[model samples]
Target: MRKWLFWLILPLMVGCQLGAPDQNAPLPILGEFEVVNGDTIYHTIRDFSFINQDSQEVNNQTFAGKAYVVDFFFISCPTICPKVKKQMLRLYERFKDEDKLVLLSHTIDTEHDTIPRLKKFATDLGVGLPQWQFVTGVKDSIYGIANDYFSIAQEDPNAPGGFDHSGRLILVDPQRRVRAFCDGTDPKSVDQFMEDVERLLGEMK
Candidate 1:
């Protein structure tokens, strides 16, 4: 297991042993931190700009004042991507009515996953912009941000579908801090992730 995955699960294990988690308690901001001048600084999502399915630019500001679920996948991914998308759709259905939440998916196969392809994919999935944004951008930029989300996205000839990536659905708070994440290929994990999403949303309120 990856180091970040261990950290994510450790809290859940402790919570189980200690009984239910405190509803009012804020979710832990995951990732590296540093102290400067006695003040702590948490890692945040780096600034990025990508064209969404609607041909509109999506950047950090697009999610301003809103919490969002993020994932990395290509429309053509043959292995875990479909499973991840199914779980992501569950999240979309559950929180589509919430005005403070959004979903962002980035395609690792930027060369083949062009704007028109992304638009068709979104349309076929019965989802649209503002609430759900399917974005594509420079290969380096897309793969680079995957690290910030604790996800894997890269090209490899031996990898299934010619790319290697992790099916992680990451949750980001309004402040751009990673609050929670789950194995997108596992339904049970996603169920727990939904609750985490609600917890974070409540915290934002």
Candidate 2:
């Protein structure tokens, strides 16, 4: 769980297909993370579980052994969720066939966004199995996972939409390490996310 430990384990856990990027690549430099300050690479997202649309249990290992993009948003969110989800949908469309790239959207407002609600949301978005997961669970569990692992999600009473937060898309590698973080709202940011995914996947080769 420590930084150095994660760095030490990264190479062993990552598949041989992922090699470091070449000199001319456009992806963000991977080893320059210390310069980014708060953006960290995690070994695991602990103590969290949520039911998928099929009523099956899903846990941290759900994202193990691949490059995954994650976000926290409730379906009823009036402002950022809609825009954030649009980017997520774009991400899903971009890599739906790239079996190693996965997507997870978590609902911050658990009381309103139940498992059934998540099912409906994913259904409306036309997301099929084995590509994306729309998740909701206990309020504290959801909030804790967001705050501790992804460093996004907050609660506010007077903010524009009753909650104050950022539109962040988190990138995690096969070993559950945070590789890159992007602003989910901007087109270029999403493009950068895609480029990063490619870089990680390229490293796999």
Candidate 3:
């Protein structure tokens, strides 16, 4: 299996063996860890700034005090993107009223997925800023951050839409730590992911 898929599946597999999680217990923080002095440090999302569909700057500050879901895709992907997006739309509807949660999508096809195109994409989905943000930025920056979410985003001339990316939905806590993730193309996976989302929201309270 690929490295990104390993990371994505590891957490979910561990989660399953634990059976029903305690409602009061915090979700386990996923990702690499290291010891600094005597304290253990977990991986965190590197700071990023991108232009959203509304032309507003979106960065870590945009999600302050909120949990966010993240994914990578292009507007024209012909394979799994549409399936992933359908699940994402489920998340949008599920958490649209929650002030403490947000959704962020990064477009890998920066050359074509311009701000106007992103705006149209969101508009067609009946979603908009502050709740769900579709963003574009430097290609390298977008691809680099995909690693942080344990997702993959890259270009391939032979790939559909000239891009290849993982269809993973990542749940990040207020501190920018990855809390949970699921295969975005699977409705059942996303259903469990929603439960994890609610669990994380409870932690924030």
- Indicate the worst ten consecutive residues by lDDT in candidate 1: 11-20
Candidate 1 per-residue lDDT over residues 74-142, each given as its tens digit: 988989999999999999999899999999999999999999999999999998878899999999999
Lowest-lDDT window of 10 residues in candidate 2?
A: 26-35
Clashing pairs in 2: 17-204, 17-205, 18-203, 18-204, 18-205, 19-203
lDDT of 3 by residue, 63-160 (tens): 99999999999998899999999999999999999999999999999999999999999999999878999999999999999988877899989988
The models' CA-based lDDT, in order, is 0.88, 0.70, 0.89
User: Which portions of model 2 show Cα errors greater than 4 Å?
Assistant: 1-44
lDDT of 1: 0.88
In angstroms, how far off is 140's CA in candidate 1? 0.1
Best by TM-score: 3
Clash pairs, model 1 backbone? none
TM per candidate: 0.91, 0.77, 0.92
In Å, residue 160's CA in model 3 sits off its true spot by 1.7
| Candidate 3 Cα errors over 4 Å, as ranges | 1-19
